[model samples]
Structures are given as structure tokens and as C-alpha cells.
Target: MSDRAEAAVRVIEGSLRKRGRLRDSHITLAHGSGGKAMRDLIEDVFVGSFDNPALAALEDQAVVALSELASHGDRLAFTTDTFVVNPLFFPGGDIGTLAVAGTVNDLAVSGAKPLFLSCGIVMEEGLPVEALRRVVASMKRTAEQAGVYIVTGDTKVVERGAADKLFINTAGIGVVPEGISISARNARPGDAVIVSGYLGDHGTAILVARNELALETQIASDCQPLNGLVETMLRACPDLHCLRDATRGGVATVLNEFAQSSGVTIRVREAALPLRQEVKGACEILGLDPLYLANEGKLVAVVPAEAAQRVLAAMRAHPAGEHAAVIGEVTGEQAGVVVLQTVFGGERIIDMLVGEQLPRIC
Candidate 1:
């Protein structure tokens, strides 16, 4: 088509588009029947809010130009994660927010520049349409803030008892620039271990929201995207050995992964660990360990000893990493183990978590 003709066609397509509407207050199986009702739900709630050309196409898939991808980097980094956090909505973020941030962080930790995402939703029948709208809205806002697009997705409805109220699965794609290689196994014997910010806020926030723990203090989930922070760190020191977002199993689990992968011992000073007073209090009251609590907007990085100060300075300067701190160091002794030098001058092993500390917390 000629350029003018193509422009006219786009105008016509835009004019034909209508904001979707539905009369039902709650979702029914009909909404998932792949008919007008399904179309309405997707358009009015998702498409209207997401508002992007690739998603507005409403095809079975999204197609991007290879040239656009080439501009970002050399390799593609892909990751997928499912979020089933109870209550659907929590302080600071909802299931929709987790759906995006979780997948984006997964890609970011791999030293990739996140670019696009796909969302898949499984909702129980009879859910309120307003609830769905709110969650979808959150997804749109989070994706926009992350500077990525939600270009494709799927929706399914199951029997009321067959699934939770709603579950979201987000898969992300990013580009890894050439010469920037990072892996869980890349840690060196003299590397420094650092965390982006305060720990356990997400788990603590969920606990408070659930009211299952009977806690009464102000705390919000640290559920922000981390690609921006990761970018700054890479610019400061491209030779970062390892990067992992502390999620399900928390910082302790992430350290264990690095230690085992790199065949090194991680020695952390307990006092150096940064903690929000509220989170620490909650953990202490509940006989829980803060190091094993989940974090949504935090990352643990292994930096070469020489670049540790520089990388940490850069991290502390970034919005996502303002509270960043160095908590530990990698050593050659006790390969594959993490040791803690306690505040009282005693040492103990920080073992890999065997069971879920805070379930459904991602």
C-alpha cells in the first residue's frame, strides 16, 4: 500500500474501534465463550486501558519488527511467572502488578533490557467484573511505568472451586546487549553481596493485609519494577557476576543459589543487613527470619570486590535502589554454603530454605 493509502486505512480502523461495554456486574462462563461477551471484557477492560497499537491489533499474537529488537541488543532474554497471591489486591500492588513486575524483574536480573510482555489470566466463574477491571487497570499502569508493552494475552474461566478468584501469568521478553554476560554461577571468590533495598516488605505487607498475623503497623509491598535500577548498575560495572531478585525464598535463598552455582562460600554480616523496623518487628514477633521473607522490588547482586563500592554507590543513587547495602562477601572456603557472622560475634550457617516461608507471596 502507498504511504497515504496506509495512513487512510489506519484512520478507518481507528474510527471503527468502539469502547467495549457489558451489562453484567459479574463475570460468567459466557464471558469466556469466545463470543461477544468475551470480546467486550477484553476490549472494555483490557484493550481500552492498555491502549497500544500491538495490543489493539487484537490478533492471536503480536509481531514486532526485527529492526526494533536489534536496536536494543544482541540476545533475547525470556522469562515467565505465575502469580496467585491471595486477596487479589494488596497494599502497594495487586495480582496484576505482581504479574508484570515479577516477570520483568526475572528478565532484568538476567542483565536484559525488558521490552515486551504477554499476560495470561485464569479467573473463577462469578467473579465481579469491577474486580477484573481494577486488576486489568493495574496491569496497564504497571506495564506503562516499566516502559514495556503488554502485546498479547489469553483469558480463561474455570469452575468456582477449581481455581482461586484469579490467577495471572506474565511472560516477558528483553534484549541482552553484547559483552554483558551475567549468571547465577558467575560469582567470584572475592565478590561482594548486596541488596537493592529494605527486605521483607512484600511478605509483611501481605501478612498485614491478610490480617492472618494480627499485626497493626503501616507497611506496603515494595512492588516496583527493577529494570531501570539494573540498567544503572550495568552501566557502572558491566562485569557484575550474578543478579537475582529475592522473591519466593528471599535473600537467603538467592544467596544459596549463587553460592552453589559459583562453588563459593557467602559470608554475610548480620548487622549489615538493612531492615525496615516494621518488617523486623513483625518477623521477630512471629518467630520468622527476615532474611527468608519475600521481596518484590529488591535484588541481590554479586559484584567483584573492586567494583562493589562503585556499583553500590550507583545503586544507592537510583530510585529503585536508594536503600541498597552490602550485606556479605563471597569466599573460597566452604564451597556452596552461606555463613552468617552474627552481631554477637558468633557464626552460623544459613541453609537453603526447604519449605515455603510465605506461600503465594509472589
Candidate 2:
């Protein structure tokens, strides 16, 4: 930011503090003691940032009207996830973004429209109050982008040595539309396999962000909310069979889940896999396979062959899926298996990782 912008923000923050609010520059254990300190942190930082009618109530639990949920769909889709990324911030996102996006995408991929999220935070003592405020702002922005609300949350503080700088857990609730039935077990033979965009960017970004490889590159985490993109795909192909946003185990792992659950075989062309140049280079340097690398913004979809092109086109038209491609198809020949047709004209089996390929990833 420019000097002018920095000054402007400081002035605004100074004014806020001068008003006898959020007086602390850093967090202490007292913030978790349920005293005035805790109230100030919750009111000034969390609820203040996530300004919504439901959260403003400041009740022990959020109370959402049943009719509001019934208006959107017939069934509820609820999911929870924790974000423990090593660094609080990254190239394109932060722990806050992951907390919201991860839970929201989980609901979205299940063919549900995400509605509300609950946040739970654990802060390490001595952390900067500014960091917490920044993360809260990120969560609010991301929730808005996904068309959801942060309606309730809790905060706790731990001793400096007992925890990382920060950790976040988010649980989301979404409503599934009537007549939509998406599941890993829904994939079948002849179904087309599609991926939303470039793969492995999130994992690569974290790896690069750590500077552990001592490699310099301009790779940013593809960590935007995928709910919008999922909705666009649904509009084009309402009968989407299987859907999932590949995270820890990446696309390969998600495909494996579909294959095993549906009792079918999934074949993906290695050449058809979308990859950024930097990711490919990094994977090669680390002797890793890009197929197993994680992605935050991308999704894997299985749709009937007749509607594959239409869905792919619709996805490509959306900003979130401009690089979308049909990687392969489902087959009945080998049940519970994922095959990768290599660029080298060979077939390789894509299996789940036996252990952690990378840890502390969202």
C-alpha cells in the first residue's frame, strides 16, 4: 500500500481505540477469561467485523429460522473443517479464508447452497491484535463472496508455547435443492470426469510460501470460494453425479473416493490434467506428483456423457473455472480403481497417499 493508504488506516484504527474500544495491542490469556477483556475482544474484533443481525444478537447459539432454510431446499448439508496452515497469511489467502472457504466448498460440492457458518478460534498468547482483526476481516469478506453468513463463533486463548500463532475451525450449514442428489457413490460408468481449473496451486503456494525449498516463484494459492462456480455448473448440469473440491489428497484422492464408493473405475489422462508451469516445476524439483497435490479453488465433477460438454462450457464461462477441462471418464472394467493415462503413453495407477505428502495444509 502507499504511504497515504497506510496513514489512513492508522488514523481510522486510532480513532477506534481512542473511543475506549479494543484497547489492547496484543492478546493475552485474559482475553479468554470471560471477563471484560474477553468481551472487548469478542465485541470489537469478531462480532464487530462479522456484522450481521444473527451474530449481533450475541446469544450462546445462533437461531436461524426454519422457513428460511426450507425456502432454498429440502435437506440440510452440514460440514465442519479446521484450518491450521503454518503461516497466518499467504499469497492469495490466509487461515481465515481457508476456514470459511473449506467449509463452504464442502457444502457446495454436495449440491447445497451454503447459508451460515460458525467460527471457533484458538489464539496463542502474545499474538498481535491486528492479526486477529485482519483474519476476522478476511473471514467476513470470504463469507460474503460465498453468499453466506458468519452467524456465531467462539474464541479462546492459549499459552504462547501451547499453540501455534492461530488456529481456526469453521462449521457450515447449507440447503440442498430438491431433486439434486450428488454423492461420491453417484458416479457411474461412462460418466465424464471434469476439473474446474489449474491443479496443485494451493499446495504449491504453501510450499513456496515457506521458502523451505529456497525456490523463488510467483505462485499464489488458488483459494477462492468455489460456491459460485458450483452453482454455475449446476445450472448447466442439474444431474451432476459426483462432486468434490479436492483438498488434502488433491484430485487423485477425491477420484479414488468416488471410484471406491460407486464401485467403478475412474480413468484420467495425465496430459489432460491442468497445471501451472510453476507447479509442474516445483513438483519435479520435489520429486512429487502434481496429481496428488492439493487445490483450494478447484473442483472435480462427474457428469453424464451427454451433458459433459455443456457443463464444461458453463464452467469455463465462469471466472472460477476458466481452465476447466474434462480429464477422463468412468469405466466398469476395474472397480474401485483410478487409472491415469500418462503423457508418455503409459497407464499408471493413482492411489491414495500412504502418509502425509505435506502437513499443516488447510
Per-prediction TM-score = 0.94, 0.94
lDDT of 1 at 277: 97
Question: What would the TM-score be for candidate 2 when compared with the true structure?
Answer: 0.94
**Predicted candidate 1 versus true structure: per-residue lDDT over 1-362, tens digit per residue:** 99999999967754564543666898888788898678777877888888899999999999999889989989999999999998788899999988999999999999999999999889899899999988988888889888999999889988778898899999999999989999999988889999999999999999988897787888999998999999999999999999999999889999999999899999999999999999989998998999899999999999999999999999999999999999999999977999999999999999988877777887
User: How many clashes show up in model 2?
Assistant: 0
For candidate 1, report its TM-score. 0.94
Total clashing pairs in model 1: 0
Instruction: For candidate 1, give the lDDT.
Output: 0.91
In candidate 1, stretches whose alpha carbon ends up further than 4 angstroms from where it belongs are 1-17
Candidate with maximal lDDT: 2
Query: Looking at candidate 2, what is the lDDT of residue 238?
Result: 93
Q: Could you tally the backbone clashes for each prediction?
A: 0, 0
lDDT of 2 by residue, 1-362 (tens): 99999999978865575345687899999999987678778888887788888988889899988999999999999999989998789888999998999999999999999999999999999999999888889998999999899999988999988999999999999999999999999998999999999999999999988876668989999998999999999999899999999999999999999999999999999999999898999999999898889898899999999999999999999999999999999999887999999989999899987699999978
Q: For model 2, what is the error of residue 362's alpha carbon versus the real structure, in angstroms, after optimal superposition?
A: 1.0
